[model samples]
Target: MAADPPPPAEIPPAGPSSAATARAGTTPVHRLLPVIVPALAVGVASALVLLGISLLAEKLQDVLWGTVPDALSIGRHSSLWTIVVLTACGLVVGLLVRMVRGHADPDPATTGLVDPPLAPGVVPGLLLVTVLTLAGGISLGPENPITAANIALTCWLGRRFAPGTTAELWISLAAAGTIGALFGTPVAAALILSETLASHPGPGALWDRLFGPLAAGTAGALTMTLLAHPSFDLSLPPYTHPHWGDLLSSVVIALAGAVLGLTAVYAFPYAHRFFRALKHPVPALALGGLLLGLLGALGGHLTLFKGLDEVRVLAADPSGWSAGQFAVMAVVKTAALLIAATCGFRGGRIFPAVFVGVALGLCAHALFPSVPVALAVTCAVLGVLLAITRQGWLSLFTAAVLVGGAAVLPILCIASLPVWLLVTGRPQMQLHEDGTPLR
Candidate 1:
């Protein structure tokens, strides 16, 4: 469905009495009450949907990676199994995209976190493919497809029941809810929405405009917290104090990560073009799967799937691998993310990018033992996310959340400035239908 048009730059002026009443807080409170109720409903529903799909994917992942591999009496992490499963996944997702209604709502390569609401019929197929991508060891995160699915479902339902609400409101509530559920916190939702809403001129105070989304985000975050108990912290060694040298190291490491991330961003359009040239989803995805399989084999199972769990494993023993090994894993995972995204597999880039950043940071620390692990990891994550996601608040939040440290924030904020300058006007990782970069 086409997106709702933006609200006019200037709303029709309110009458003097209504304006006076709004200033007295009577009008705004009544206006917000209606939105708050529906926003809460949307938030709970969004969390339920996200949790349902995630649980299903986990079960499927167990069967694919656990049951079948054990039944075959082969190591689950064996190179041969990695190649076979990934290639097969590509073929399966390719067939689904070819046959499913709405073709799973455009090439995922062309979409972002919050896009135009899709027809309700498209949600099921998108969710199914998303599950397959997650379960099939594809190196992508659930964020994009799940967010899109929630937004589409909420918008369709809201239009029917809450006809008084605008589609944009439903979209915001759903997006915020899903983000809250994903991150296990409403703060992430608030940070992201603040950046997004700041760009569009709207009436009322920012807090007033944020009321519904915050309600939804809180509900979603609480629901997910009660049910799943997810955590982003890596439990790395504490970064208690910042030193003069720490700031220098953080900047250097952050810049290094930005360079690596920008390399993938620059390569994204060409990769999409290469896959599109195949002229069919089947061939494109099949080839993509095969390549990813090869990458998985080279990078090992540590590099497969979304990087969330794998990142923890890496962090548990940063010294287990040498700097060279970390470099190889970082490069391989970045390539895998690029291929998975471009080859029509459904997923987000952020999780895998985090893994890359962590790997890069570890590599830095491995080479220079003087740098603190927490500081290294957070700065690298901040730099990579700044370049890749192009959202300053999200980059800083994710980086800080990963380490669970307030001490690193000061350095990260400083380090991000140069990285942001580096990526600001560059082409994004996303693409237009014509295969041009979304600059």
Candidate 2:
């Protein structure tokens, strides 16, 4: 009874101060620890993973289509063959995902547009799948995989730094920065992140999220400059400058762009549903491939893939293309993208979207005969991008840089404003059943 009474003298609960004292007593103090631990670990891990995946994509591209007798032969392929290839790829992808759960076999329509950022553990597969899809004539681009990998890497690193505090936010910023670096415009990346990040929050939460974006973007830019990766291009034309006429024309062009952009938005979801209705990835994919082939049949091989070579060629030498050819290319390329995107092929709509804008812009320039080719192309590119992305500054920068001149910046920026307004006001796409924004 006496011992029980003594034990009843309650031990006071440990307070925060006591806990801190205990922690301080045991915590190791190594001055080199902080610097050595996070920087070395995150940096090296990110670099190795990114580089490995990048090399994998390159090698896979070579394995699939590098041995072509000629790049032009890409267009000469038959629609049936394209369909067959697409179906086979879809079959493989579906089979692969069959056993996996929680995003193992991503649906194409849901993959880039609707899905959240991928985890690092799944990035390699995402990269591999995309590379194969693109190489095999899927109407997609590298941007999806690039963005996926970037966010995945950041999430992986962030989790290591702090168990789970704001990991998704960090991942989002990393995604923006990576895209910005890839596109060679940090400002655009910031704008895209801002627009994409905006949500109806409780009062001050918006500002809270911005911090990670800024830091991530800064880090990404540093990485781009230091690494001297392919995305470091900042080329612009010195001689070019915007004329008053360019501004006026851009306004008109933006209206046209709004129509087309909205059309794409509307068509995209329906196309996705059409493919998904098939309920079988293989046949759906094959049908998409056949459609792609048929589309390419009209434009030749240049219309295949995500249209990078076409963009490159046009950027380098616009004279190689005629008005008719550009129009055909635009239609075919758009169709191919719609099919590939809606089907189970893993890829991005961004590049193909840009290409379509460029084509439309060039076509408008040709048909009108009043707008300068450069001005029209620049305006069209910005308009379409703005329509698709609903991002202001990013679209402005993209319009300027991709066209290679600051002169068009004024026109591009001015024109993009209205287009942004209109497109942004339109109904948000039903990218997911729950009405959430696609990644």
Candidate closest to the true structure, highest TM-score: 1
Off by over 4 Å in 1: 1-26
RMSD of 2: 10.5
lDDT by residue (1-439, candidate 1, tens digit) is 3332222122111111223334554666666666667778888899999999989999999999999999999889899999999999999999999999999978888888878788999999999999999999999999999999999998899889756556677888898899999999999988888887776656767777777888889999999999999999999999999999997999999999999999999999889889999999999999999999999999989999999999999999999999999999999999999999998999999999999999999999999999999999999988888888998999999999998878889999999988888899899888777777776
TM-score of each prediction = 0.94, 0.77
lDDT of 1: 0.88
> How many clashes in each structure?
0, 4
Kindly report which residue stretches of model 2 are placed more than 4 angstroms away from their true locations once superposed. Answer: 1-54, 68-91, 99-106, 111-121, 197-212, 222-239, 368-370, 428-430, 434-439
Question: What's the lDDT for all of these models?
Answer: 0.88, 0.58
What are the per-residue Cα lDDT tens digits for candidate 2 across 273-329?
787788776677667766665676667766776765567666555556777888788
